[model samples]
Target: MAITCGLVVANIYYNQPLLAEIGRTFRLSESEVSLVATITQVGYTLGLLFVVPLGDKRERKSLILVLILAAALCMAGAASAPSFVILAAASLCIGIFSAVPQLLMPMAASLASDEERGRVVGKVMSGLLIGILLSRTISGYVGAHFGWRTMFWAGAAVMVLLTGILAQMLPRNQPNFQGSYGGLLKSLVTLTRDLPVLRRSALVGTCMFAGFSAFWTTLVFFLESDTYRYGSDVAGLFGLIGATGAFAASFAGKSADRKGPDFGINLGILLFVGAYVLLAFGGYYLVGLVVSVVILDVGQQMTHISNQARIFSLLPEARSRLNTVYMTAAFLGASLGSLSGAWAWTHFHWPGVCGVGLAFGGMAYLLNRFYGRTASVIAPAL
Candidate 1:
């Protein structure tokens, strides 16, 4: 599950480290180059809404395998793209199929006991975060050395390997669901409208991802500017530094198990608020960049794990659908953040980008505080 999910999630980030190269190769301005990030994110959001929910209705194992295969084909197509439009289209396809990871998260939670679900989901998420955070470094280094096209090919190869592994190793899941196709869509609307579990979880998760997206999407631009000329290798190293978020995932997951997702999430929100303030100050210096990266990732991933723990606990029988809501919101924020960050980079440079991060962090902190108060009253009943 970990390997499978990792490969899927990595698709979103592999292009980040190579953004500068893509811009140069395609004769693009900063924001235009940013279209690479924005387009991929938009694709992922679409997949989250459409592709991920299929896991609730289908045999998850088969569904994941098929999506993995399709994503691999997309990556291969991206590698051979003859024009920017083709590349962007192929990126969207990759995002659409990468919904496999969303399925894997809920699957891990479902397979575990309620008390253990957070930790199990965290363990799975650790791999997903690692792939997300590290792919930039790997893609950056490799993209710098070999070319961006080769990075897609590499992703395709990994998809093939994971697909074979998933096919052979994953056990078949029993079918358990209610309603026809129309009813399924209706229930989705009902779930979105009535479920506090989905509402707060999706909103907070989205804000945290926005904070994460704002920083990372602009980071490479920072590195390439006059302040630093270290290029993609250095940009890649930040991904490794940011892997601290994976460790925080386990910590947050375990904390959610011990306390509850509500408390855990608030703590994460506070952490992000603090980290971004530090980033506001540190945005200019290299050492400050490293420090901010570590804290930022840890805070972001912690909130994410907490949100998953909360939402998955809400519906044991429909974890996949819940995940679809959570991730759809997250990817939407990410999509907006990528485009906004690019615009920030163009107009305000690092400071403008910092405003986006601060705003998102502030929004998350306020919303979670409000929700936490409500949750306190809800908890006595729980």
Candidate 2:
């Protein structure tokens, strides 16, 4: 399941490192090309709000298989697109259907015992994060050696394989919600309104992912700049360095299981702040960039695992709905971050990007400090 999650989620990120290549192909401005990332995230947010919620109301295995197949077709479409508009439209479809991972996570939580839930979630999320990191690495190399179209074709093939494997191996999860789809959608509002932990987790996740997205979306441009003059292969290699954070996911999960999730959450925010501080000097030195990548990824994963553990524990029956609320907000933040990162890069360059990231980290820290206590208290009981 973890591997499958990682593979599907990887589709959304392959375009990041290839942004320069794609832009060159279409003769697009940096701002126009950046919309590929932003719109993909927007499509993901829509999926979270609409498709992921169906996890609770449908047979999960079948749902996952169907979505994976759809995503594969979308990837094919992206690979064949002759114009930027066609590619962008295909990217949106890919984002919408690649949400199979979100469905898998809640299903994993449902299967695990409370005592081991965090650990289980951590393991699966490690795969997801590693996929996020490695997708860039793989795509960067492939897109550089072959054309960008080849990378999307490769992703489509992988998704087809995953679809077959998951179809055979995945367990059937009976629908928990018996209501109509309309009611299921309506209930999302009620869940958000009544659950303080959901609200806080969603807010914190939003800010953290915004910072994360900002860094990644602008990184290719920064690397291509005169200051660095690095290629996509080097840009992709950073993903390997960032994989250090995959280790933090398991540790954070175990830590949350042993202690309360609050400790890990707080620690994550501090690391986020420190990461940006280091990244502020990244343009000057390679070491600064490497160290910042490790710190930033670790911080982001830690916060993510902790927030998820807390939210999953809140509603046993409503795990998918809770995830829907949390992830929708997170991806919405990602969309905003990608847009803002492109803008900052265009107008102010690397330092401006770092400033935006720092502001986002600061906002997350402040939100947690102010509301975390109340949310924590209400979480376990919800």
Candidate 3:
């Protein structure tokens, strides 16, 4: 399940490092090519809303299989797209169906014993975060050496293989919800409305992810500037540095399991803020950037794992819906961040992008500080 989650979720991130090449391919402006990342996140948000909730309403394995097939086909479409518009549309489809990881997460949570749930989710999330980080590394190298289309084609082939493996290896999970799909969807709102913990988790995740998206979406542009004069391969190499966080994810999860999630979450926010401080001052220094990447990724992973650990503990029967609400808000923030990052990059360059990231980090810290005390009550109820 961890391998599957990582492989499947990697699809949406392939475009982040390839935005420049993609722009050149279609004769697009920086702003226009940036939309590729923004639109993909938008599609992911939409899928989280319309698709992931079905994990509770339908047989999960079947739903996952169908989505995998759709993702593979969409990847093929993205590889063959003749125009920027067509490619963008294909990217949206890819994002929508690539929500398989979200399904797998709740399934993992449902199957684990209470004491082990956070560790299980953390282990899986470590895989997910590794996929997110390494996808850029792989895509950067592939997109630079071969071509962006080739990268998509490779991703499609991986999806085809994953489909078969998952079909055989995945255990059958009974549907948790006995209701209409509409009722399933309605329950998402009810879950969000009633659970203050859900609300707080979603808000914190949104802020962190917004900052994360802002940094990643504009990173290539920063590297390509006269100061760095680096290629996509160098941009991809940064993922290796960021992969340091994957280790922290497991640690954070275990910490959450022992010390409660809030401990890790508070530490994560502090690290996030510190990472931006490094970035803001480091300018184009390679050492500074590397340190920032490590801090930033670790911080993000810590908060992410802790948040999931907390949310999954609330209403076991509704893990998927809770995930739906949390991830939807998170990706919506990603879309916003991507869009804002593009605008910031175009108008104000690297400093502006860093400012946006720091601002997001600040907002997240404040929200957590103000509401976190009360929100702790929501997690232990289950």
lDDT by residue for model 1 (268-327), tens: 777777877877787678788788888888888888999899888776777777788888
Q: Which residue pairs clash within candidate 1?
A: none
Q: For candidate 3, lDDT tens digit of each residue in 240-347? A: 789999999899989999999999999999999899889989958999999999999999999989999999998989899899999998999899899989999999
Off by over 4 Å in 1: 371-382
Q: How many residue pairs clash per model? A: 0, 0, 0
Kindly report which residue stretches of model 2 are placed more than 4 angstroms away from their true locations once superposed: 372-382
CA displacement after TM-score superposition, residue 267 of candidate 1 (Å): 1.6
Error of 2 at 333 (Å): 0.8
Give the Cα error of residue 285 in candidate 2, in Å: 0.6
Q: Give the TM-score of candidate 3.
A: 0.97
**lDDT per residue as tens, model 2, 1-382:** 8898889999999999999999999999998999999989998888899999999999998988999999999999999999999999999999999998899999999999999999999999999999999999998899889989999999999999988888788989987888889989988888887788788889999999999999999998889889789988788898888999999999999999999888899999899889998988764588889899999999999999999999999878889999999999999999989998999999998889999999999999888888645543333222
CA lDDT of every candidate: 0.83, 0.91, 0.91
Instruction: Tell me the spans in candidate 3 whose CA falls farther than 4 Å from its real position.
Output: 372-382
